[model samples]
Target: MASTLVSIAGYHVTEEIYNSSRTLVYRGYRETDHKPVVIKLLKNPYPSFSELLSFRNQYTIAKNLNLPLIIQTYSLEPYQNGYALVMEDFGGI
Candidate 1:
């Protein structure tokens, strides 16, 4: 489910959260009885080839981890001229 109500950093997020990355990260929330979750929004206003490659690497790494301790990558979608990853809603480490 895509949202435009809130934004973290520059990427569109579900709620306002402080994240220390160039990409925006948010604690996803919904009014329609939904579970807590973390949503990562890819912030690439003008992505270069290397940046795209790095994102691909991140995708690969997330796919390979496939274990506990690390949040699971549930889905990836194209959004805001970039991509977003919906992951398991494990709270901050």
Candidate 2:
């Protein structure tokens, strides 16, 4: 989608891992820390308001979680017309 043409500050999108009408997940790295991270962004061409809210709520809950079993959320930022969720990368094991 249009997100492919955009870039997220402090992160380099190495490859796209998943894409759907609601979200896009990318294999990326944090520039400042040089750590691998997974970047999840809301797909462009805006989704419904309810969907957007759901996405935000999910991220909010993820950010607050402290369970060892769950991947920790790094940060969230405003993307093109949506939001981006950054989490620890867990690929290529």
Candidate 3:
């Protein structure tokens, strides 16, 4: 099921937390720093232009937030033919 994304070079996905038609969310960590991270990736490796735009919009909104309780977004990365939204993982989702 396109699980090729589980072990990318900079991140290691420990477990998948959610799956939907549009996205895949995983609990993972940054390889170099061993920092826990949440990865939200587009389900399709090659999504349509509109889908890509929506995904980017999600990242933009998340990264701009300054709320203390909301986990912070670290980066929006190109991965596995799609994009992965990396965020701070507070252990529970």
Candidate 4:
């Protein structure tokens, strides 16, 4: 299996609590500020190419629909099993 490296400069993945469906919680730091962010990771088990595409598309649609209530995506990267989405840091905001 190929591994995907997610590079977040000022953040670290939290080992405490995580939800399999909705979020990848992380502890982030910038200057003197310590923050938490929930990154939405694209998930699929034994997914074919088409399945992966479906997940991607559905995620896009869901993200578009929930734009106002939630934070916007800051970046996206390919992961080992799926894709990693970097969302807006909303710790202080």
Candidate 4 at 91: error in angstroms?
3.5
Which candidate do you rate higher for lDDT, 2 or 3?
3
RMSD of each: 5.8, 2.9, 2.3, 6.5
Tens-digit per-residue lDDT, 1-93, candidate 2:
555534888788888888777677889799998999988887765767887788789889998999998998988787866788888887742
- What is the C-alpha lDDT profile of model 4 across 1-93, one tens digit per residue? 553433454546543234466334443433235545545554453557775677577557656765577676554556667665556666542
Error of 2 at 47 (Å): 3.0
RMSD of 3: 2.3
The lDDT of model 3 is: 0.87
TM-score top scorer: 3
Models 1 onward score TM values of 0.66, 0.83, 0.88, 0.47
Cα misplacement distance, residue 14 of candidate 2 (Å): 0.2
lDDT of 3 by residue, 10-76 (tens): 9988888998898889998999999999999888878999988998898899889999987899999
Scored by lDDT, model 4 comes in at 0.53
Which scores better on TM-score, 1 or 2? Answer: 2
Find the 10 residues in a row with the least total lDDT in model 4: 23-32
